[model samples]
Target: MKKNILYLSLAVIIGLLGGYLLFSINADSTNEDLTDNHNHLETTENQMWTCSMHPQIMQPEPGDCPICGMDLIPAETSAEGLAFNEIKMTENAMALANIQTTIVGSVEASDEDGIISLSGKIAENEENNAVQASYFDGRIEKLNVNYEGQKVNKGQLLATIYAPSLVAAQQELITAASLKESQPALYKAVRNKLKNWKLSDKQIDAIEASGSVRDNFPVYATVSGTVTEVIAKEGDYVKQGQPILSVSNLNSVWAEFDAYEKQISQFNKGQKIKVTTNAYPNKEFDAVISFIDPVLNNNTRTVTIRTTLNNKENLFKPGMFVTGKIEGAIHTTENSLSIPASAVLWTGERSLVYIKTNPNEAVFEMREVTLGVRNGDNFTITSGLKNGDEIVTRGTFTVDAAAQLQGKKSMMNKSGGKTMTGHEGHLGIQESNTENKPNSDLFMEMNLPVAFQIAFQAALEPYFKMVDAFVASDANQVLALAKTTLEKMKAIEESHLNKMENSHLSKSIEILDAISSNSDLKNQRDQLVVLNENIVALAMNIKTPSETLYVQKCPMANSNKGAIWLSTEKEIKNPYYGDDMLTCGSVIEEIN
Candidate 1:
């Protein structure tokens, strides 16, 4: 009975072992079949592969993109031969980047020479401006030109005045006329006095012949002009040399411009300006710069630049608003290539542009460029491009996206951020002039985030602390701390770094390496700048700090908000120097 029981157990064990082997084989076969099916489906599907980060790279096989070495994604082919790496963006990314696109026509430059924009205003010509004054004390009996902006011709009667002085002068002229044969010298003196009172020769002769005292006398205009002022009206009294009316010539007009401090260097006397008026669009008048005010007008904070225009048709009246372009020929450097201003992407220090090659092909590579003076809409391409090299005048941002997809070095990722191994010296990474200067201990730092701080502190704290010691003028501590810090920061974390491949932390590590290797700093003076910059970057990832003011959400102390200054912190001002909250301020003020 014992033998039978043992045999049964052995048999059951053998059967169980055989069943397990069979199940394992079947599972292995199923897995192989699934893998094969996946490969077959990938091959069967008509999917074009391209790099997500470097769109310029494309391959038929399922492999990494050559340029960036990132895994390939499907490319969206279009009829125009443009394969849009269509990104299905979340609502958040759209709002953050302010991404908007419109179907626009190809931008073309106008053939007309560049328009010179000048800020100016209407002014009366000095030669045409006149003030009408009475030669003798008189009372105005009638006014023909009674109000401002009234037009009058030369020698036109403007008013009639009844003056006692004029009546006495006329009587004296009459007496002189009667005694001319007996007292010729006295008669001549009396006639001259009447003439001095603005009595014309004909009027004087008539007054002498009539022998009656005329109380009212007509005042005639000395010159043709528009009436700018009327000092005396009908039945008003006027004193000698008192202004009766003021007039200005309307045949010509002056357009005065306020030249800003920067534009003054471009202007010169006699420069021709093409003037136009919204009142008359068809007509364009040529004007010459007649005067440039020697002193800047303190009220407007600008210098007056005057130009005269011919107004024969009287179209340009005084106080008529006008605008015009002044065309001035400027010399440029020989052999300098000019590109559309839209081509250059300005990123603070490094300005970049994309050169379009392979016009017929679906692909165009990005080439970094340097720029020179901007002449109107066209910029002079100093280096990194040749003439006739088709550049992306429009849709550059789109092309840059393709570059990033290709896993190539780009402006944002290459200059200020981490780059691939071979792209070391391609970026301008030396300490900024502000950082290089030996300055005070108090440094204005950029606010960064906590995560960035931690990562950076791990690699840079030692070097930074040593630099701080050096700043305190402790030479021995500086030397000791600097040595340890540099070593620890430089210690390669290849294994750990590999785990964080393609992460922001990985890129930040590259930035750290470059900064540590950079020998531009005389000492560790620029560590504060780096720390502040790092802090600001980290701050971007987290929610910005906020405070409550009257139940409304407001930015926290030392934060930026548009126009509204509300703070819970004391002693901290906004970037625009607005008032701080009671809660905002320095916890500990540093001694300078």
Candidate 2:
């Protein structure tokens, strides 16, 4: 009985010990799992998030951006050793954008092997133009040259006239001839008077030999050329020195070209130019620059350059389009680097280009450059660049856009900061994308024609309708209204607008075209701001507005840079932010 009791006690102890050992193993496993979970929670809490467009918005946890309502992204630190204005781009991004870099190299002046292209039209050489006029007042008895383009020669019989004055003078000559021995001085004076009337010696001798006065006289052409205009018709009386025919000698013609004001220094008289015409594509004619207008045309910002081309074959006709290629001799900039115009971007008063700072990486930075005269498709950089420097010559705008989105110094944003993001579309709002837009001031005193103002005002009517659609956040309505606006803009007559005003209207129409076809509310609204800039300038310059149009401004719109829009009513209805901030603008001017 004692042995059985001890064995039962040992078995009970072994059961208790085994149970304790199992409980301890389970407790250790549970503690390890709890610690691992805590570490994972701490790691998640430590990661901060930020909005890509609004880098200023930072949060410990991922969520929608408070300012733009965009999805939060993990904030990335700027590349090490990068300047405040410089931004690094991945090789994949550069390849996708097709960004190409060109190393600055010196090029010989366009005069030496390079051709400076010029466009112009052929015109009649004014120096060779002449007016065949009547030397004496007489009625046109018969007209030999009937129509324009009739070829005539010098001293050819142009017309026959019955001149009462010349007949009376002829009779005096006849009478004076008879009494030559008694009145030799009178006879000599009468002959000299006939000579003064442009009478040839042979005709005078015949009159003397006939001993009779002829009533009708023959009129001859003074110059040989094609008749451009028949000034006097048959049976019409003309006064002395009155044009009977407008003649132009087509042996030579003028090739007139307009040189831009900026390129005035590149041209001068006596420079050789190679001329070609579309009609004669295989032929090339050589000519020398005969004249260059000293005064600049304020309207076109160009000066007239003329060259004389021999047209003996009658190849060049007046008003025919011609192209002139002059060897650039004056601006022989030896060390200056010529860059493609595509490499440059202009915003407001600043001119910019992107420089690839790192040779091995796709890092880039914005550079402000002073441009010299443009030769063909390239321009000389007077400042802000040097030889061996690498620049983005192609896909420059793409690089600028990347810089803008990455909050680096860009053509649009001189000082780097967050720009508008796509998230604005989520709330049916899209702020203006204008970068340093020009002032919307009235130039009413410009005195554009009243007809033009009326037509332009009609164009603005549909723009106001578009604004209403934008305020309602109806993308379809915006598209329809934009199309209507584009039609109105197309109908605007550009004959009355000056060069600058025409440029404004053209850009406005281009933007309208984009807005019309776009279905995205954000992009359309963003384009709308750019369109309004041109539209407002045109509205203010309206010399005679039929009705009052309000010019309203929202200083907080367009990422706090401010924007303007035209409205028929003085009440503010913000299109950038619909009901969110309906009246967030104020009228700055009443355009009329």
Candidate 3:
């Protein structure tokens, strides 16, 4: 037994020594590997942090983002070898943002030949218009061409009229025909009177041969054209010489253009112009200015210019929008550079553009351009730009956003955000050059298009009803109203919104969908905090001031974070707290 125990102990001792040696070897290898790569690894103390939503918030340590109240992530190193005025963007970002660039050209060398553009809509040519009038006083018994846009041919039966006077006249014609041998002069006079009623000689002879007095007479179309209006309906009495139908020769149309007072000098009667419409973007219709209004419109500061277009194929509609381009005076290359109007951003009194700094890479910088004159869809840069310099012609706003995220100057004015009272958590994205005073008209400078404003106004009406539902704390009603409001929002026209505002609108839709699915009041209100950010941003910039909207804020809502909702009334009806704090909110801003 002692010999067996000694052998086991020796085996155990050998296993322990082998394990120790392997551990020591691993420890030494790990130490060498780490020490060798220590220089390459980034230190935790030196790491920077930034927000995913608001990339401008950069901090030295890991914490929640000050702007969004979200956890920060390690910041990516910026592109090196860039000038102070330049900002570098990745190729992926450029493609995703749809950043497009175009080389600036001289106004004289442009394909448009520095054309002066005029905005107007297609109108019916009045020169070839004719009115179908009744030759005799009668009541319309039947109408063949009843509605507008009906085609009518010359000599086609338009309507049948019932006339007692015509019946008496027809009786006289038969009597006069019977007594023609006795009173030849009287018979001729009676025949002449019947001829005066626009009756053909055959029709009068047939009536006399049948020896009958017809009460109904047929009226034929005097002109071949489209019926524009039906003045006299069936079973209605029409006086002699009264218009029964309006006929317009639609083989031609008028391309009426509105020229601003500044462009009036460039236009004259008999000037040749190129007219185009969205329907036929690839085609240009040549026309001559037929007329120019002698007086300028005081309300619009514009004058009317008329051109006639051949529309034999029915290509031009009356309400179709059209543009008239007239060749404008061209300047030398040294005089000015022409760039697309989409590339320019107007901020306060400054016109800004983004220049593609690198020819081979995606690097951009902001430029304050001196705008000279706007010609057609292009603008003339007097001094700020030079020929062959590439600029952002499309997605200029997206480039501006990228520049903003990179801590670079952008088209957005260095002006501060709205510094409203009562905790503006969502609106606290401070600009780099705010000078410590926030401009209350934060979104006023956004330059929302009239089309977007009109659509948003239509959608916004239903949102107030949804707010009222929230104020009543009726979750089911809120859900129904959310659906209704969302339905309205789906119809909103987003083509006119800028890139940033479009993004805001998209996010608002997502939050609203979440709010619609949930029944909990707290959850819905929580989502409202984010949704209101987008809505208020749009509201502050609406160019169409139709009504007085009170922007009421409740600081205690959104879990101590403030939230706002627009109201048509001055009274505060708290949507967040309902009856518990119905009047807890205060008016922060009023959108007129």
Candidate 4:
């Protein structure tokens, strides 16, 4: 019995040892699996995060975009992703943004010359202008040319003057003729005196034959032209060498274009010009540059470039507005790349464009380009681009806005926010703080009348309403408010104000009228920029105590040149950007 018990104990001990060893091995394997799983979770949590709009921003954890204040998304960890400057867009995002691209190619060179556009007025050619004057002292007479603009011919009877001096001379001639047989020299002297008085030899001969003196002598036109001015009436007595009328030959006319100081260098005498007029839209008149005025108008800072155009068809009338174009050398270098003006975004002196870096993908990168000259709808590129490159031509502004949001290289942010310290000194805010503050003594200096002040204040109400509409991004409301503003402005009579005030009011009305006609929000906003400038001028020149106004500026507005608008409150609600960038501006001034 003792031996059987010992065997059972040994078997039990062996089985327990095997079970303990297997459990220990399984525990070590389980711990290893748990460690591997924890590492995988850590890797997922530490993935890089980036903003969809600002691709340049990268972070170790998911968060929001600092620039645009948008939600952050996971950045691509694959090696096949785009480079630092390049931005990738999905097909849906591109369609939503309406982004379009164009494949660049070499444009065929042509012999056509570039055009230099000019604005001017049709004026009378002073060289062809003539003045009709009386040759002898006269009494009341019959005038043939009744009104201004009357056509006259050379030697045509213009007037008949009843001159006592002429009658006396003729009587003397008759007396001299009677004594001719005895004194021939005296007869010849009288005849010569009559000839000097503009009397024809035939008239002198007739007077001698009839032995009578004429009561009146006829005056004839010295040149053929249209009557420009009738200086003296027929009933009024005139002295010898006194101007009666001014005539201008309409066969030729002068086109006087106002050339800015910068454009004066492009003008030269004998250059061919093609002129078009509003009166005859289909017809184009050819002319040659006759002269460029040596003196520049100090106030206007412009010189007059005169071109003589043939007016044989009588189509070009005086005082008509015209546009002249001169063929000249192109401002751009040969074989340079040219892109549409819309494709460029200007930031002060910097000009930038978006180039498609990848043909197979929607990848774009911002590039700074050197601008040469601006053609009508195109701009000549002097550097920073090459042929056969693809670029964004349409919706470029939208693309730039996206780039700015993504913290990429843009017109406003060149370093792509890599060194961005904070938003404490934003461009719009900084400019508003220092530059455009209203003067406290501005109203005190203006000696405006009370009645005129009331009228000006009333005109600002509709303008305020329009500002609210733009803030809300309601285009329909903007249109309605613009019309109401225009009506109020037109109702303000200019006669109530003094000369300077009237001038300011008239300009404001004209700009408001233009704004009222445009239904497009962008166009209306552009005009609003000018309208606000005029309002500021008016406010500075005239006191309006009944209302308080605020002048705001958006450095990003008007293609980044910056634009100003009038507001009722100190807070900025940018009219230029509407909701796209609602808080993109700041209050610059306070007016009362």
Top-TM-score structure, candidate number: 3
Superposed model 3: Cα runs more than 4 Å off: 1-70, 74-95, 100-122, 168-197, 200-209, 231-233, 236-242, 258-260, 274-286, 295-304, 311-333, 346-376, 383-391, 399-415, 418-592
Encode model 2's per-residue lDDT on 1-592: one tens digit a residue: 9999999999999999999999999999999999999987766665556656544333556778644456887655335577878866655445544579999887763334456777788999999999988888899999999898899999899988778889988989889999999999999999998888888889988998998888888889889999999989988998888888899999999999877777787777789999999789899999999999888865345688999999999999887878888874445457777888778775424668999998988778999999776665677888899999999987675576557555678754668775333232211112232234335222323456777778778887888889999887666688888889899889888887765566567768867776776554555665666677678777887765677888887777654657788888989999887766899988878866
| Per-residue accuracy of model 1 over 405-481 as CA lDDT, tens digit each | 33444544562222232222111111111212211111223333444344444544564454344334333354455
Clashing pairs in 4: 53-406, 54-406
Q: Order candidates by lDDT, high to low.
A: 2, 3, 4, 1
Candidate 2 Cα errors over 4 Å, as ranges? 1-121, 146-148, 205-216, 234-236, 256-273, 287-307, 320-335, 342-368, 385-592
C-alpha lDDT of candidate 3 relative to the true structure: 0.73
TM-score of each: 0.43, 0.49, 0.53, 0.47
Which prediction has more favorable lDDT, 2 or 4? 2
- What's the TM for model 2? 0.49
Query: Residue 429 error for model 2, in Å?
Result: 17
User: Higher-TM-score candidate among 2 and 4?
Assistant: 2
The residue ranges of model 1 lying beyond 4 angstroms of the native Cα positions read 1-115, 297-301, 332-592
Give each model's whole-structure lDDT: 0.53, 0.75, 0.73, 0.71
- Lowest summed lDDT over 10 consecutive residues: which window, candidate 3? 430-439
Residues forming the 10-long window of minimal summed lDDT in candidate 2: 422-431
- Candidate 2 at 329: error in angstroms? 2.1
The number of the candidate with the highest lDDT is: 2
Candidate 4: TM-score?
0.47
